[model samples]
Target chain A: MSGTSAPATAHGPHHAGPYNPAKGRLGMWLFICTEVLLFGGLFLLYAVYRYRYAEAFHAASGLLDRLFGTANTIVLITSSLTVVLAIFEFERGKPTRARNYLLFTLLCGLAFLVIKSFEWGAKFEHGLYPNAPHLMSMGFGEILYFGLYFTMTGLHAIHVIVGMSVLFVAWRRIGKGTLMRTRPAFLENGGLFWHLVDVIWIFLFPLFYLIS
Target chain B: MAETAAHAGAYGEGPYFNPETVKPGPAGWLTTTNHKRIGVMYLSLIATFFSVAVILGLLMRIELMYPGQQIMSAKVFNAMFTLHGVIQIFLVVIPGIPTIFGNFSLPTLIGANDMAFPKLNLFTFYLFVAGAALAIGSCFTGGGAPDTGWTFYVPFSLKTAVNVPLATFAVFVLGMSSILTGVNIVSTVHTLRAPGMDFGKMPLSVWGLYSTAWVQILATPIIGITMLLIVVERIFGIGVFDPTKGGDPLLYQHLFWIYSHPAVYIMILPAMGIMSDLFPVFSRKNIFGYKMIAFSSLAIASVGSLVWGHHMYVNGQSDTAGIIFSLLTFLVAVPSAIKVVNWLATMYKGSIRVEAPFLYALSFVWLFTIGGLTGMFLGGLSTDVPLHDTYFVVGHFHYIIFGGTGFGIFAALYYWFPKLTGRMYEKRFAIVAWLTTFVGFNVFYFPYFVMGWQGMPRRYFDFPAKFTELQVVSSIGSYIMVIGIAMIIGNLLRGAKKGEKAPDNPWQGATLDWSLPSPAPLENWDVPPTVTRGPYEFNHSEDDK
Candidate 1:
C-alpha cells in the first residue's frame, strides 16, 4: 500500500478540505453529549434537593420573576431559530443573508445575558444571593435552592457568552468570504453550539422559575 | 524476516528514527500534532509523575517502617500521602494507558494515519501538564500542601484552609482534558477506521480504548461539576456539604464516588484490552473468544458506573441502596471474570511464548485474580463494614490498581518498545525487573491484607506495636519494587539508544501494527491499508501456530 496518493494529514481531508458535513456534525453532537452530562450533574443535584425540600424549592421558585424568566426563554428560543436560519441561508448559498442572521443570533444571545444579569441583580437586591447573610436566615432548602440557581444559571450564562463568541467568529469569517456555503461547517458548528445553549436555558427556565 | 524487511522499508526512512519526517528538534516535538509524538510526550510526562509519586510512596512506607514517625511530622505525612494519592490517581494511572498507548497505537492498529483530532490531542497533553503543574504548585503556595486526601471528602475538604481550591481546580482542569481526549478518541474510532475494518474487525485494544472513551465522557462531567461545587462551597460557604450549613456530608460521598468508581474502570479497561491483544499474540493462537473480550469492556464500563454506591456502604446509606449497590458490584465482576477466563482459554492449547511481556501478562492474571476476589469480600455488606478503612482495603486497592493496571502498563511498554523506538530492550534486564517487581509487589501489599484483617486502620501516621512487623515487611518490599521500577525505566531508556534494531514483526504477531516498519512513519501507512482479515488470524498461518 505505497505511493497511491498523498498522505492524509492529522485532521484528515474529511474535515479540512471541502468539509465532510457529517464529521463536523458528529463531533459537535459528541461535544453536545458531554455538555448534557455536565448539566445533567447539576440537574441531579436539583432533583435530589427538590425532592427533599419540595416546599422550600416551590417557595424559592415563586420568588423568581416568571415574567423575566419567560422573556429570557423567549429570547433564547428566538436565537436558536435565528442560528438555524443562518445555517439555512448558508446552505442556500446566500452568504450575506447568513451573516446577517448570525449577527441577529449574537444580538439575541446578548439580550438573554443582559436580562439574566438583571434577574440575578434583582435577586441580590432581595438578599437571595447564594451564601449572602440573608440566605443564612433562610431555611436550609432555600439556601440550597438559591445556590443551585446561581450556579446553574451562572454556568448557563457562561455558555451563552461562549456561544456568542463562536457566532461572532463565524460572522467575521463569513464577512471575509472564507466561510461561504462551500465551507459552512464552522458556521454549522457555531449554530449547533448556540442551539445547545438555548436548549439548556429551556430546562433552566422551567426548573428554576416555572416549576412551582 | 526478509519479507518483513521488504514491507518495513516500503515506507522510506521510518518516522521513529528520521528526525525530518517526525519533526526534528525539541521545539518541533513541543508543537507537533503527530499522534505518535504526542503519545511519546504523554509517556514521558506520565513517567515523570509516576516516578515522583512512587518516591512519595516509598517515603510514606519508610515513615511507617516503625510505629512512630521515622522521617517526617504527622502533618508532613498527611500531605505526602494526599499528594501521592492525587498524583498517582489523576496524573499517572487514570490517563496512563489511554494517552500513551491509545494515542500511539489506536490509529496504527486500525490502519489510520493519526487520531481524528490531532491538534486537540496535543491540546489535551498541554492541559494535563498545566493541571499537573497546578497540583504540584499548590504544595508551595498558601497554607502549605493540601492534606485532604485525593477523594476530597466533605466537611474536611470544606474546612481545610490549605489550598483545596487550587488542588480541586487542578483536578477540574485535568478532568476537562480527559473529557476532550474521550471525545476525540470516540470520534476517531467511529470515523477513522480503514476501509473494511468494521467494529468487530478492529483490534481488541481499540475496543478497550473506545469503551474507555465513553466512560471518560459520561462520568467525568459529574466530577467536574462536583469539584466546581466544592470550589463554590469553599468560596461562598454554601452548605451543600458542610453540616453547619444544613448540607448533608453524604451527598459529597455520593457525588464523588459517582465519577471515581467508574474512574477505576477508566484506569483498568484499556490495560485489559492490552492483555486481550497480548494473550493471543504470545500464545500463538487466534483469540479464543474475541466477541467475549470485546463486549466485556463495554459491559465493565456500564456495570461499573452503578457500583459507585458500593463505596458508600459504611457511610450509612439506606439498607436497600446498600443491597442494590452490592449486587451491582458483583455484577461488574462477572464481566471481569469473563475476560480472565477468555485469556486463559486463549492460552489453553497454544505454543505460549514466555517472553518478558507475556510474563507480565501472566502475572496480571494471577495478581488481578487476587485483586478481584478480594474485591468481592469488600463488595459484601458484612465483610466491608469491618474492613472498610482498614489496611485490607488499602491492600486490595493497590493489588488491583498497581498489580493489575500497573503490570498491564509494563507489559504494554515492553511489547511496544520495539515498535515505538525501533530498538529491542535488553531482554534479561526486563525479566529481572519483572521478577523483582512481581515479588516486591506481593510482599509490599499482601501483608496489608493480614494487618488489615487483624484490625489495622489505614491512613494513620503510626500503628500499634502489634502491626510493626508486617508494616516493615511492606516497607522493605517497596524499596525492592522501587529498584525494579528504576531498572525497567533505565533498560528502556538504554534500549532506545543502543539496543538491537527490531524487525517489523518481532513477535510474529498478526495485527496491523506489525505490518508496518518497526518505527512506523509519520503518517502511519504510505497508502492506507484495506483490512482483509481480523486482527488475530493466526489459524491461517502454520508459523503463527
Candidate 2:
C-alpha cells in the first residue's frame, strides 16, 4: 500500500496507476448509477400504469396523507444535510462532533420510519392490502394504483430501515473514536447509500402522494 | 506490579482483532478487507446454498419417480421448483465462481496487493448476506415462498399469492451487490496490476473475470430493474405489463433476457478461464495460443450480450430479432470453440498430468462441449421450436451450468484450496470424487435429452407412463450425483483439518497467487510482486525439477 502517493494533487489528471479513492468513489457512483437504472425499470412500470389509470391513481393519491409525506421529505432532506455535515466534521478531525451529527441523522431516519409505519397502519386499517378482492369496489384503476403505491412505498420503507441501520453503525463507530480516520470512507459510503434512499423517496413521494 | 502487568496490553493481544490482523482467525475474517477473506466468506456461504439447492434438485428427481405427486402436494412441488431455480441461480451460480474465486484470487493473479476498493469488497459481502436473509425470510412469511420461477415472469408473478415482493426485493439487493463487485473488479484490474502485468500478460482467469465483470455491471441492472417493476406492478397494479392497462407483457421478457442472456456467459466464462489456467500448468507447456484464449473471453462476453434475444425467439419476437440473435449466438460459439481447440493444443505433445484440477478441467471440456453443442441446437430457430419449454432446454442449461460452470468451480477449488488453506487433499479420493461426479452427471442429465425429444415438458410433477422409465434412470442418476457430492465434501472438509502441508507452488504454476507464501500472507502480498513472466509459462520456473 505504500508507494508514491499521487502528489497530493487536487483532482489531478485522474492518476492512471495505483489505487485512487476518487476512482473508487467514481466506481461506487457508477454502481449507484446502475442502481438507478435498475430502479428506473420499475419507475417505467409506474409511469405506464399511472398513464393507464390516471383517474384511479389520482383518486388513490388523495387517500395518502400529504402532510406526513411532506414532513418525511423535509426530515430526509435535513438528515441528508446532517449526514454531509457529519462527514465534514469527521474530515475536520472532530470525532465527538461528528458523532453527534451522525446520531442526529440516525434519529431523523428513525423518525421517518416511525411516520411511515403509522401511515401504513392507517392503510391496513382501511383494508387497502394489494389485490384485495374488495378493492375492486374502489374502482378498477384505483385498485391497481393503490396496489403499486403500497408496493413501491413499502419497498422504499424497507430501504429506509436499512439506511437507518447503516447510519447507526457509523454513529457508533464515531462514538468509539475507532472509525478509520485517515480516510472518511465509511461516512462517505454511508452518505452515498443514504442519499440513494433519499433519492428513492424523491421518486416515491411524487408517485404515491402527488401523482395527480 | 503484577496487577499492572495483568492489565498491560501485549504487542499482538487485543480485546478484538482489528482489520490490521493478517493472521487467520475469527477477527481477521469479520472486519478484514483482504479480498481473499471476503472471497472465502462468499464461497463458503454460496457452497451452503449450493448444497441446499442440490438436495432440492434430488428431491425433485425423486418426486418425479412416481406418475403423480407422491412425496409432496402440487403446491409444494411448485414451491420446490421455484425455490430450486431461485436459490441456485442467484445464491449459487451467479456468485459461485465470480465473487468467491474471482474476488479472492483475481487480484493475486494480476499481482495486485488488494482490490481497488477493499472496503467495498467487504460491503458487497454484507449486502449479499442481507439479500440472502431477505430471501430466506420469505420462506417463513405468511403466504409461503415465491413460486413464479427465478425469472418471475409477469402476470403470474404480479398475481402470485406468496411474498413475491420480498423475494424480488432480495434479488434486487443482491443484484446491486453484484454490480458493485463488478465495478470494484473492473477498476482493480484496470488500475491495480503490477508494472509489468499488461492486459496481455494478465492470466486468463483475470481476463475471464474482467469480461464477466462488465456483464455484472451492465447486464445485472436490467434484471434488477425488471424485478423492481414487477414488484411495482404487483403492488400498484402498474399496467406496464398488464394488458388491461394497455401495457405489453412481452416487453418484460425482452428486458429480463437482456440481462439473463449474458448471465449465462457470466456463469461459464470464468470456468473457461480456470480451464485455460489448468491446461498449460498440467501439460508442462505454454498455452498454444494464449492471446486467443484471453481475447475469446472478451469475444464471448461482448457477443453474449447481443444474443439475449435468442431466449425470446419462440415468444412472438420478430423474425429479424430472432435472426440477429441466432447469428450472434452462433458467433459467440466460435470463441468458445477456439478456447477448446487451444486448450487441446496446449495438451498435445507435452507432459500431461491428470491431476484432480486437470481431471475436472478435462471433464469441463467434454461436458461443456456437449453443453455448447446442444446450445447451438437451441439457438437455431427451427431446432428450438421443438425443444423450447421441454426437458431438452432444461437438460442443455443444466449441462452448461452444473456440468460446465459447477465443475469448473470444483476445478478451481481443488486448484486453489492449497493456496487458500496451505493444505493438500487426499489425491485418490479427489480423483474418485471427480470420476463419480463426472459419470453421475452425464447419467442424470443425458436421458433428459431423450425425454425432451419425445415432447416431455419440464416443471411437471406428473408424467405419462411412457416417460416413467427414463424418470427412474434420472432419479438413480441423481442419487449417484449426490454420493459424488458427498465424497467431495468429505474429502475437502477432512483434508482441511488433516491433509499434508502444501508447498507454495505445488503445481509449479507461474501465476502470482503462488508467488506468495502458501495460504497467502495477511496482506495477501507482504510486498507488492512484479510479474516476471506470462501466467502460462511452465518452464520459466527456476526451481522446476
Highest TM-score, which number? Answer: 1
Task: Give the CAPRI rating of model 2.
Answer: incorrect
Model 1 accuracy (lDDT, Cα): 0.86
What fraction of the genuine interface contacts, i.e. the true contacts, does candidate 2 reproduce? 0.27
Model 1: per-residue lDDT, tens digit, B1-545? 11233234446345654677655788778998777888999999999999999999999999999988689999999899999999999999999998999888888887777787777888999999999999999898979899988999989988887999989999999999999888888877776777667788888999999999999999998898899889988887767777776678898898899999999999999999999999999998889889989999999999999899998888989999999999999999999999999999999998888999999999999999999999999999999988998999899989999998999999999999888998899998899999999999999999999999998988899989988888899999999999999989999999999999988678887778887777766666544566667888876532353
Query: Tens-digit lDDT track for model 2 on A67-137?
Result: 99999999999999999999998998888888889889888999998998898888778877665555656
TM-scores for every predicted model: 0.96, 0.79
- Per-residue lDDT for A1-212 in model 1, tens only? 11122223233322221234665576788888888988988888888899999999899899999999999989889889988988898899887998899888888888888888899899989999867898889898898888889889989999999989999999998888877677688888888888889889889888888775
TM-score of chain A, all candidates: 0.90, 0.86
lDDT of 2 by residue, B167-262 (tens): 988998898888888898777776677656777788888888988988898789988878777776766664566766555678898888888988
> Best-fitting candidate, measured by lDDT?
1
- TM-score between candidate 1 chain A and the true chain A: 0.90
